[model samples]
Target: MHRVVVTGLGIKSPAGNSPAEAFATVLAGKSAAAHLPALLEAGVPVTFGCQVPDFDPDVYFPKHRRRHLDRPTQLGIAAATDALADAGTPDAGRPAGPGTAGSGTAGSGTAGSGTVRCGTYVGTGGANIGLTADFGALPHDKLPVATVPMIMPNTTAARISIRHGLQGPCLTFSCACASGSIAIGEAAMAIRYGRIDRALAGGVDSMLNPFAIASFARISALSRRNDAPQEASRPFDRDRDGFVMAEGAAFLVLEREDLALMRGARIYGEVTGFATGADASHIVQPLEDGSVAARTMLAALADARLRPEDIGHVNAHATATTYNDRAEARAISACFPAGSPPVTATKGVTGHLLGAGGAVEAVFALLCADAGLVPPTANFTGGPDADAIDVVHAAPREIERLPVVSNSFGFGGHDATLVLSPR
Candidate 1:
């Protein structure tokens, strides 16, 4: 069996775009949630969310290329482009490749050109939100000139494959919030089984307009804290309201450990274990009993050959919602049995990126293992009603063990967990 390791990490996130920047920003306990005047002006009941700050598509793609690309697809392309570059993947330049500044099928994948085939796997909560509705509403003459590629669910992964010339499989996983983590896990499985040596895996999501915001608000799953956007996502807090919707993307360059070492790539951490499961009982709500969630974590631990005590920290999938935080906390307590590890619920800072949340938080988990210190949960204020977990709040804490576990439970009862350890 092959060992999988992360050679590069990239993101277009509200905290910061680059992996280092985002990790540092989260560690400093800065919440990126903010009030969107545009949404409010559009009469969106929930005006606050965690929007990517100052993101520019013009930087990732020329106007001609991005004409039909939706907001989420643009974010995905930029993230993948950056990840491949950071991994030292040869000829992986984009936003510009050759004539288009890319050929995805344009060139060979790595340095020294050893036999290698790279794959692309991405996940999304849903397809472009506004494009289809707008196109349907507009007259034929008023519609944009770009083709219908804007509405395809697999557009981001397909575009990444074509631009980088990846010959291996290009797949998209759509399991709501677990989409990104599932994509990454499946990519690791492909490498471990020798189907592919390298891959770009992650997630992307954008649902920030009135239509989507109103949908989430209608379900009462959004924090209605427009007056205090920064503190809106208070995961595991006594007064936690609900999640703050966000839009962003994150990608990681996964390659065989032997290949990465041979090529002198910077190894962030190894994906020691991964497992995904479902509650099988609810559509949006988790099994409050936490049985299924606990089993999923145990399965992941068995895959990594580690016990609960071996985990130094946990990147909890605490969306700050009433049900999710409570259910996840109960699962954590059940899984550990001995005692829960230091938990850092980052939604308190980045809000909830939906499909992209898993991949983005996975990146945070891997980096946390590499750094050997757990960042504090942004805005968490422990109190009587908070779940009984060792939530890292108030300040960051140092830890001795290096392995970290990241969890993601999506709508439709999808649950995924990854065990990452420093190289």
Candidate 2:
């Protein structure tokens, strides 16, 4: 089996568009949450979220082709394109929009001398649900004819596959919040087992629409601090309410370690381990005992052939909800030794990207390892169980050459973990 390494990353996230920019924002403990005009105009109960700033679809896609794609697809395509380019696979002779048939090397089965086999795997929580809601609000006769193509969750993967001429496997995972992590894990596994030479994998979700926010609000899953949007998502804080809903996309290019080295690719880090499990308990709430989450972490560590003490930093799945923070705290305590690795939760700044959360956090985890610094958990204050683990806040914490674990626990009890190590 081959070893997999991350060679490239791209993001259109609430934190930032580029990995360096996002890492800087996270290190500074900045919150992207803010009042959104669309939410306010729609009269959503919660009118704030971490929306991606300065995102222009026209920059990635042509005006004529952008009309047929949904917001998530647009974000996904942009991220995937950037990721491929970062991996030294430029889209030569490719069209300016998605859904176009591949031409020349872009459509050829082989790229970079026919030695590399590439594929695409992406995840989304809802398949263009925001667009679906828009269609529902419009008259039946006025519905766009391109609805099917625009709304499919697999459209993002398909676009990436076509755009880069990846012919190995094009798949999509829809495991709610764990979707992105699972997709990335599957891609790494494919490379490890020689199914593909490399893969573009990540997650995307553009659900900042009124219907989506209102639905989450109805379920009591959103923070209510509308007046203080910047502090609304206070993960691991005593005053925490619920998660803030955000929309964004993140992608990474994974290649076999030897092949990346052979091509002299700029390796970001190695994906050492990945594991996923379910609580088998509730659809919306995790098991309070955190046993399932603990098992997930243990399994990931085992997969990496490493002990708990080897982990020097943990990127938590803390969403700022009451039950989630408590349960995850217990899980973290159960997984690692006492007062060992520093823990940080990024959702306090980026808000919850649902399916995209895992991918974004994974990127942050890689950046932490690469930069040898653990970003602060924004808005964190002393909470009831915050002492269960060492939560990094106030400022970035520096460490060296230690493995990092990024965890993602989604609704419906889905839990995913990824273990990363410096290259």
Candidate 3:
């Protein structure tokens, strides 16, 4: 097995548009949760979310393509463009020698010598809201238009591939909230196993629709704290009720260690191990036994040649739900009995990005690892179950270590864990 490393990252979230801005906000313990204007006006159950403040797809895309794509696809495209540009992908038509100026290199000075061998993978919960909105704009008397292309889950990845001229392994993965992280993990595996030299991996979701809110409300999954929108997503807090659904996108560039080195890329971290499994217990509820999730973590550790004690921090899948927080806490405690390393949940700030949650949280894990600080679980007041673990609350905490685990546990018992180490 070869080594896989992250060369670049791009973030478009409620906190900010750029990765640096978002990372700084996370480290500062800032919360982007606010009363959602559109939802509140529409009388949705939940009134707030970590909605992107100034996101105008037109700023990133031209007028023509914007018409066909949805909000989720637009977010994915913007994020992917930033990631690929940051990775320094070379021109499409011309594949010249080592000294050419236009040669695509992986941020490093080394010119790409071999085939581009780039692939794309995206994870999304809701796809093509803009296209759907366009349909809604038409009068009822008008004939139903073929809006089929807009809402497909794979549309985001396909659009990304088309935009970048990537012809390899173009695929999309959806594992509920863990979709994004799983995509990154799988992309890394592809490169590590020599399937591709470079890959774009990330997730995007924009479900701020009335239909989505109504469905979640019916299921009692969304917080009904319309009074205190910011405090609604109180993960690990005793007062916490439910998760706040959010919309955003995050993407990262993964490349073979050798390829990254040859391109002189500025490495953020290495993807050491990734594992996924199912509880096979329940669809809505995770297994209380947690044997499968724990094993997944252990498997990742084994694959990375690290021990439970080697991990310094964890980017938890704490979704602010009562059962999930408890089950996840028990699993972590059981896996790392020796006072499991500092655990942090950023969803309190960004809300749950559904299919994009795992990927965005993975970015937080890498950023925290690089910055040497455990980001706080924003808006967490206090809780009995939370105090049992070293959950970072209120503010970021400095920590010492190189390796960290980012866990994403989704509905349908989907559990995925990825181990990352600083470059």
Estimated TM-score for each candidate: 0.93, 0.94, 0.92
Off by over 4 Å in 3: 90-113, 129-146
lDDT of 2 by residue, 199-259 (tens): 8899999898899999999999999999999999988899999999998999999988876
Query: Each prediction's Cα RMSD?
Result: 3.8, 3.9, 3.3
lDDT of 1 by residue, 1-423 (tens): 999999889899998988888988889898998778879898888998888888888887889887768889889989998888888774643222323212132134432334465789998997687567667878888877664677878888988887777767899999999999999999998888877778899999988878889988999999988889998899988888889999899999998888788668889898889999999998888998778888999999999999999999999999989888888888999999898889998888898999999999989998888788788988887854355689998878988757998999999999999888887
Count clashing residue pairs per candidate: 11, 0, 3
Ranked by TM-score from best down, the candidates are 2, 1, 3
Model 2 RMSD vs true structure: 3.9
- Overall lDDT per candidate, in order of appearance: 0.85, 0.86, 0.80
Cα deviation at 215, candidate 1, in Å, is 0.4
Error of 1 at 132 (Å): 2.3
